[model samples]
Target: MEKMILNYKEEELIGKIASVDTGTAIAFIPDDKKMSELQINQLIAVNSPRAGTHIIGMVVKMSRRLDETILQNDIDDKKNDDNVVLPSNAIKLVFVGELRDKEGIKVNVFKRNVTALPNIQSSCFRIDGDKLTKLMECISTIAANAVTPLSLGKYFIDENSTAYIDGDKLFQRHAAIVGSTGSGKSYCVAKLIEQMAELKSVNAVLFDIHGEYSDESFKRDGITQLKIAAPNDLETANKLDKGILMVPYWLLNYEEMQALLLDRSDSNAPNQAMQLSKQIMTAKKSIVKGTEYESKITLDSPIAYDLNAVLQELHKLDTAKEQGARGEKAGPFNGKLTRFNQRLENKMSDKRVGFMFSLTNEEQELDWLQKFCRQLMGTSKFNNGGIKVIDFSEVPSDILPLVIGLVARIIFSVQQWSAKEKRHPIALLCDEAHLYVEQNESIDAVSAIGLKSFERIAKEGRKYGVSLVIISQRPCEVNKTVLSQCNNFISLRLTNVEDQNTIKRLLPDNLGNIADNLALLDIGEAIVVGDATLLPSRIKVEEPKIKPQSNTVQFWQVWGKNDSTQDLDTAVENIIKQSKSE
Candidate 1:
């Protein structure tokens, strides 16, 4: 009732349903009304069998066809006009939902399903102006009743209508934000960040693949910014206080170590792996020789052990001489461990991956895990360390998958181990997820090892209180498994045919053709659909007060300028140092 009631008047009549089906109906507009008044995606309220309800639908297609019967007056002018055609205009309406009256309830409600379909000849009217506003308001009001409703932008159907979605469903069941390179993907993320920052308790880690988020605006009062150790940070990164994050190699499991160090092509790969595992187990045992952990320490345990000792043992086994019946022959693994040794030694010596091997004495201590997890996943009421934006720009691409996977595994593992009742839920905002979450049977060993962690999270993270927000510019390249698990999508302008089809295939069968609008969307405009939204809508994203550093550089404007303030020396020095430019 109230203002939500669709008080249809005879003066507003546009058409009558001529055909009805399971999920759609064809309405024949009267010849007196112009087809120009109808538009694609225009909301329609068709008369229903129920007393106080109407079948809500949108005009998906329209056509003007010639009537079969010849007009009596036009029959006389048959020679003047061929066949004397009388055109009839009709529209195809796909039923979306239903609008029900208050019936004594405090407010009218719009359910996603209709109780009855409109029969043939039912009058249909255009839902515009007041009716459109009221209908959109009903959906918004339903979400507004939630504890954490997310306000993204205004509906394109009605600019006056502010769009909202269920924030809990958006994250709890996972979500994805996909678009072209400059299609405001980052702006949407920054908008979400700005909104989440206003809440009392928010715990999330945004993996900043590039250093774009290093700007001051992203460094809000409650957020912490951290960077992976670079070649230059080796000498200075002894602690985690000043934002240098060290994920020591000891945190990696056995298979991860094999993927990182062992050469799979080598014939001695299996033996080399077995010996490496044995050496690691021995090293781990030394740390807890006098404690109960000694018996339970496995090669896969997350315990700080002497990697140098493992190396020495592998070398000994590599060149070991056997005590044969004669003088001395070769040992079982004399030369099998040579390639493994070389790879480990080289990676350990490389300063680029110092974050994994170059840990200080303090970091090697048993209590380091407590401090590390606390700083990254802490839920302090003051929000000092609740939100973290970890920058991995300086990390080498060769090992990017390994390092990123390591960090994600750490977060998920910690949450998995925590008691369910005491779990402090966290969101993993995986920026540029396509890099590590690749979709192919031919990915390399490192990427495969890395992909497993994310796939597991996509499959089972919800039960453990972990949510993933996958943000990428290319949906075609991102793995479908992870993308399919997402229950919500905020899709922006996508021009590529493959990328558009990727999204089209994922949409519900009824909404499949909606992807046709993907290429036509303007910048900052997106189609929002999922369990979070009561109605799939096209919205214009609101401009965030604090925007990300993803603005496209005005190349032409910069080129015309006569400014020579650019520093060549600093750029050369940064490249030489294998670090980010200041």
Candidate 2:
């Protein structure tokens, strides 16, 4: 006689394991009524010989195949028959983990790795209703024992119980949240932020590419909001309103500046880049002339320098003539520096980038970098959570990658250089990551440089207490390098075949069926998998108290309203200004 599980009952019997593979098992259901109730993603248990232990699997595929002999007879007769035959239901399950009762203890423990596969003819039971609720609660306790769990929402299988993820594992290992438009991607992110905000010293930075997260969303007691200085905010730029942001040009290293101002397509680009490098070093040296850093500053140092002085020297080089054997010969850089000069002038004069080129005198102080670091990493009354939401809505698409990468690099560098004892961990929530972190066949010099910075972070940021939360709608468009580095994934509905395929490729070979219904997921429903989760589970994310401003528009409701003509002219003017919604 088989020793029954603690809660095992005859009524709980669903079927028997017909076959067992490395990562999946096929269960045969003889009862039509029992088969009807079986649903995809539902959890089931297969009894093992070990006491208080069972193999856990999730339903991934279900089908009813007609008896071949019966079907062949009707086909051969080519005539209608009155007899009816019930088809056998085949339930395919993806093995997730092994659930066992700890020795001498009543508690059940769930391990992601399976120690044994179910043998053929093993009895399988449906773990729904009360069974499922109890199982999830037990798993939640297991998660809590390892580390503080992050309560994202409720499990799809057991809505009565909350879904918990290992918070430490989730961040220590990078994470990715992906879904289609209107699939509640932003809502999930907002909810996570809301939870982190509850901590006394939360440290995170959300790269708000479209200004999606609003003040209302983060109006919580420990959250802070900040916006980048737009074109219109230039004249009044200051830290007073806690509204201004300065990504000073001096902060960019030689390679970053080259990406911003050097056009490699030009035949003379090489010569020009060389000249620009020298001039930057000259300007940096000039700034530290009488300071202690005079002997220590490198060309890539983040020290303040006069852009005008560099431009003046470049102008002289472009017009200088050298006395040679051929009397009054043009300088080697005379004609080569013209185009480079124009590019630099345009970037410096562009009002849209005032945040980089135009900064207050205070922002140029030697200790400004220290203050900036504190603002981003400190949890003081003036700065909430050390959580900064930097809005990049007005940033141009062409330079978006470089600018965002700059900020990430700064954060990583600060943490890297800090003394290990004094280092504080920080998480970067990159919204709209695909726009800047995509893999491409051909890329411009600037984008190549930007890509390098992010790739480095993805590969090594973990060692320095820096983590990334890559958020995107199109997983296919995101860089595989970054995606591969992530050990946790929160995937919502994805309708595109290509997008679905991308997620499938990342998942383990045995769990391919697990992502088969990605396109069919309900809004806010997601399959949470990887290191953070105790077991691969489907979750229905809870709605945030204050919604993000980027929620999908109700097209039907808006179509019912008429547009106002009074503001039409102003709207057109704003569009032309390139600062319309700034």
Candidate 3:
């Protein structure tokens, strides 16, 4: 093969080697020509006695110039060009080598010759300058061939595109979106979901806590929107076509029951809950068989136990103090009582004593308790509704844990039932997850029944088709075990050192530059990584067009403006009139 060569005036020589650095070398090219940055992998001929060969190295850095002298002969020849201006003596040229050692010795230690100079030629394509664009083109090609219904518009295909998600691997498994507040975490999440939802074969269940995703907004294209709410409109509520939320008490495993029932000090809570569950099952079987008992039971049966029934039984067991033969009490019964049956019988007659035997007896107050159990057990329209959003904003703080735990238990139990083939995969979005998972008090139940269950699904549910999307402002507070199970990660602007470190550890080494750019990211730009993408990527996320109305107080305008006396009186009168109307 003939050697490829081109002749150019020596005045075109840009620079000579200034200093040799590890993995790269630097040369100060005079700005007289004002040439653009050189691309990596550009070959330059180096004249050396030991190796008079054309060497090539990729350009890793393009900005800095080092202090070194060039050969006077190369500079003198290049001075003919009007743009060529020599600073002092010579030009600096940096050579990139393929192999540094020759005959088991380093070559840079002794090699010295100066017959040739480094010059830019229009030969080989530069890898550093074009890699990003090449990758984007590859992605665009794959997306164009996608059989899935979603589309990638032309706007994301431009040459300057620095950020893009690998669209091929997204359907392989579930994904996660995590970040601190204002990290554009939500925007990334919405964009991905929007794309997925456009695909006809993909069915997504999004749990929107803030009611950010509504029917009106997500209705474009071929996607359908379903909203679940508490049964407020009694007439049409039952007939409404929506999914149900129900969890049978019998479905809760031993650990879940313990988390649901046992107090902190009860070391045997786990065992006790398990044993009690067995007893309840046995009792339920006996009641179904119509077994004879001392108490005259007709419509009410304690064996018809659910979560409410279990709670009632626990209350009875606690209150029935045993008393000695005369008036001494021993067990939960306050007065003279020895056994649970006797106390229950004694309370049956007196209205004030309260009926303990009947499961739904008002005296036992178990009737009121049955509502929650019925909600979980009965196939009532309210219970089996799709995507119920429980707005606990008005609920008292003391009972919040119980409410969350109860709901979580119900959801888990319901999902456990549907046959694997018939089961509809559900995605539970836990917003402010740190509040539930990190709390020292009243968290064990939710932790065991909710967080642990979700974590298991995160790891194993892709095959089973169940998924979880956990959102949190404080990543440090999230359980590491749970966080590690997440296959996909959408990281937003995180200023916290600990949080950044946590994310850095999860991301691959190739994304180091992308991670460094996190601090300067815009409000809706995020770095997405993990299984759902081909490689780590930075993407600009689109905002939701419509969302639930928020009650943000306009304190500045309200307080800063002068309040008119007439307006104040009118507002007070309107408030009083509204109160009277209620």
Candidate 4:
């Protein structure tokens, strides 16, 4: 008891609690006090009867209101006295956690439930300088012992101490990094990748939707950059080369293939789908003959087959004629499979989708799937390959979701089928997730197939040693199921009200007020929350050693000093070719 009193006496008391509510305590300030000393979001402590513990709260709002009578008098009189003071001045603080000692070690441990609210008129003291630094150090020590701590930035209240989150939980539980454009979302991702790169065996695949991360500046020993095969590269791409990614059509399951070619509006869609599935199964079976997996392979197996054979079979079905009651009549599938065949042929012939449909005939080899799996899910520590960043910039937007879904489905399937002991944990960093994972209300069969693939992975990926780091600028646009599955969030400044509200709704009720500063935050600063962080904190993310190519252009400076840069003709040609610009 004496020690408690001594500690409280040594601290500078700010005010006394005037009232206590559910999770907030109101404190009245004395007129003589300098209000400028107190800051919103600053941590403070309330004296508790407990022997060695104090109730910690965060200052969220402060207001000074004059009485009606005082305001009327001042308005009636020509002049008002400057010395007069308002009577209703108070500060509201939300109880965050408790600062206490355990086993002789003092730390700021977060707890959602509070045993007791501060007593009315209890003294409040500001936490600053040495006291704040010591508390942070204790928390840091606790986090260090509990999990693999990753240093993010300095704590908002005590800049002298660094902030950290559990690196293990951050990935294992899944995470999202969200912010508006130019608010450092990409930088935060770069920072995380940089930290993970320090680990010798870390395997992360970043789907570069816009090809922004393929910069030569990020080239390093551990970083292996690759791109989806373009229309022109299909003929020359070597089957064994890992630098060019070609996802054969054989990898897509029945539903996914339907998504790409099945047009629900057609009256014979059902017949077309049935014939397509049957032909694909037969095609796969024919290719696996004499192979070890021949007896085990299923219709959905990732076994390459001759797409042309399937087309030929469909053509025969559409043209077949069988004897009827009187004379030769059309077959059951005659003309029904014609439109489906046309759609399939069109998709296969389209050069833009070469990555999915234009693989060399060597893809039919029995070892093709095995080799691609090793190239994708393999780790640098064991296989001398790591950190594959596949650029999807050349993919058309209409089928972007389906294409990305194919890759994710493949990765998940590989991870799921591998022996538990032999599985290498992989993290899929999805940049611009909203583009593919956004909600689609059209009820189209095509959209639902892609949506379901990602939804399943979001729900069950963690148990199979697969993690996702979804990066997006519009939290509202991203799928709710995917966002809800994420247990950690590193949210930068979000100016949109809907986006802000989406993030706010995800927070616990007790700390909902903390999100009020979301729009007010500066660039590179984010509110870190969820299971990975010991406490919900605002941290300034450190700049990555090698940044991504996401920096905003300096329009004003560029316009001030412009020069002749003649490259539009080549750009137009590249656009027409539907390929990357040289």
lDDT of each: 0.84, 0.81, 0.44, 0.79
lDDT of 2 by residue, 365-396 (tens): 88888888777666644585567887888788
Q: What tens-digit string does per-residue lDDT give for candidate 4 at 315-375?
A: 9999999998999999998888888888888988889888888777666667877877777
Candidate 2 steric clashes:
0
Query: For residues 454-535, could you state the per-residue lDDT of candidate 1 as single tens digits?
Result: 8889999999989999998888888889999998999999999999999988887667656778999998999998888988
| TM-score of every prediction relative to native | 0.93, 0.91, 0.56, 0.91
Error of 3 at 486 (Å): 2.7
Q: Which stretches of candidate 1 lie over 4 Å from their true place?
A: 1-3, 32-34, 66-88, 380-385
Candidate 4 Cα misplacement greater than 4 A, ranges: 1-6, 31-35, 65-87, 104-116, 144-148, 239-242, 382-385
Q: Arrange candidates by lDDT, descending.
A: 1, 2, 4, 3
| Best prediction by lDDT | 1
RMSD of each: 5.1, 5.2, 13.3, 5.5
Worst 10 residues of 1 by lDDT: 78-87
Model 4 residue 189 lDDT score: 87
* Number of the top-ranking candidate, with TM-score as the measure: 1
Candidate 3 lDDT: 0.44
Pairs with steric clashes in candidate 4: none
